[model samples]
Target: MNLKSSVGLLFFLFTALAKAQTDTTRIKSYADQVMVRMNLDTNIDQFIFTEGPEDKQLETILMTNNKTRLSFSVDYRIISATLSITPRFLPGNNDNELKGTSSYTDFRFRFFPKKFIQTVYYKNIQGFYLENMKDLFPDWKEGKDPYFQFPNLRVQSYGGSTAYVMKKDFSLKSIYTQGEWQKESRGSWVPIMDYDLSIFRNLIDGQKSKETQYSFGGSMGYFYNWVLGSKKRVNIAPNISLGAGGMFSSSWDILDDGSKANRENTEYFIFKFSAGLHIGYNTDRFLFGGKFNVNANVYNETENQSVQNNNIFGLLYIGYRFPPPKVVERNYDKVQKKIPIL
Candidate 1:
């Protein structure tokens, strides 16, 4: 099926199963409160390509210049949304001179209903530079030589994941969004299915090429929340997951006459691995936390060639929870009555 059809199907399935359920003895829900948060994070989008014989192997690393991102988020009832942007003024994001100018923007929305968590997101990234310039050119100097850059390369992805928690007491929301607080320590096995459609564009020597990729995968993950402190306000959680999937890719070259040529199609198997740790301090009104995560996707391009997309990032956030304003509550109630699922 196409991207839109696939996404719509997922939405319908999740909505059919939507219900408000939680174990109050082990988890505390903030569905009645409006939570606002600010987050600072670092995002890395790097692609590594390897080719050639074992003795004379070569590798190329392409990476975006903007590494730091700022985000604002709001959570109320069953919905949570966040918007993130890479600002050049942030520390470690101002190396455009050496790495090339890049831009990144992301928007994410999530829903929590019973034991199911559904998420949808969109990402836009542009510009990339060769990060291993020294390895490629032995005599290249960091400050003296400019790295090779791809100014006309852009990538956009529309993606979503559907997940279910197997244990009723485990609070995945506490670890993911701090929308809830787990009063007791607990763990759960979560099964997740993910799907995405991505578009890549590049221009070289007055020629433009575009590629579209459709991917889907399933994974099993284990998450644990270790609540500590006298007031159960501290939590330390770690999680890991492994999965395998496949991608269908189609590419075409745009000719000067505005027609397409050199059409190609390929299919590949993909392996995915991810791990993360979260530490947070939570209170009735305030919450603060930090998380570190790493994700890698590896796929073979040819008999002797491979590609890896590796992303490693860290995030810190602070949030406050408060009662919703009267107008906001009234409007949300009216909408919830009509939708029922909310």
Candidate 2:
């Protein structure tokens, strides 16, 4: 389906399931508590382009130099938000001399209503260098020779996902946002819909080009949260999903005379796979966890050319929960009186 239609369908499904009955016997809610989290992660933003047939295929990998990110987040009631940045002080984040300078920024927000989860995010990434220089050049030396770089290539994406849990007793929140805890082990089937708009800009030899892509997809995932320990404070969760989608892309170039060239449009079928494992220790007031997640998308650009976008990340986080102050609670109550959704 198209992006608009996919979004409309997600809205309809969300409203239909908004009031779906829920059982909280196996879960514990922390709606009255404010959660603050600090996270350190190694998140790679990269893409691989392959051309020609399998035996004679040529591969070009583009990757950002900033490989680590630190983020801070706060969650209260039904709302959560996070801001992330890559700092040069980090060990692996400051190799600008070898990989060229790069920058990355991300902002995300999430809302929870009953069994439905809604998320929205924005990401900005620029500057990439060829990661496999040795394969391309037989005499290339890693420290002595500089790799090919795209100094003016930038990608920005706006995206979000909507999901609903089919099981009433399972706590998806426990595995994701940590807003709630599950007292018993359980599993659930979750159906999710995701949509995104991406803009790519590049400048080469004073010529500018821009491309825009729109994509949407639906997927079904199974999540199992295995609770352990006598105190029920330790858990391991693993989830996987497979999906298919479509992408519409359009591109145009700026001519030397300052005129625009004819826009080119292309459509492609996309295949997606995502899996993750989360292990955490949670208590009423303190929590710490680690997570590993990977997502891959493959699409053919032509009969002999294809592109793959691979995202892999590992995260470690520690958080604290406490009762919200009266002023904070009162303000939220006031906002909720008008919006009602919170």
Q: Write down the lDDT of every candidate, Cα atoms only.
A: 0.87, 0.87
What are the per-residue Cα lDDT tens digits for candidate 1 across 1-342? 532353354334333322222234477989899999999998889999999877888999999988889999999988999999987778988777877899999999999988999999999999999999999999999888889999899999999999999997888999989989998777778999999999999999989999999999988887767777999899877777789999999999999888999999999999987777789999889999998777778999898899998887789999999999999999999999899888
Model 1 clash tally? 0
Worst 10 residues of 2 by lDDT: 13-22
What's model 2's TM-score? 0.91
Estimated TM-score for each candidate: 0.91, 0.91
Residue ranges of candidate 1 with Cα displaced over 4 Å:
1-25
Off by over 4 Å in 2: 1-25, 256-258
Q: For model 2, how does the per-residue alpha-carbon lDDT over 148-239 read when each residue is reduced to its tens digit?
A: 99989999999999999999888888888899998877777899999999999999988899999999988888777777799989987777
User: What TM-score does prediction 1 earn?
Assistant: 0.91
Q: Which lDDT value does model 2 have at 247?
A: 95
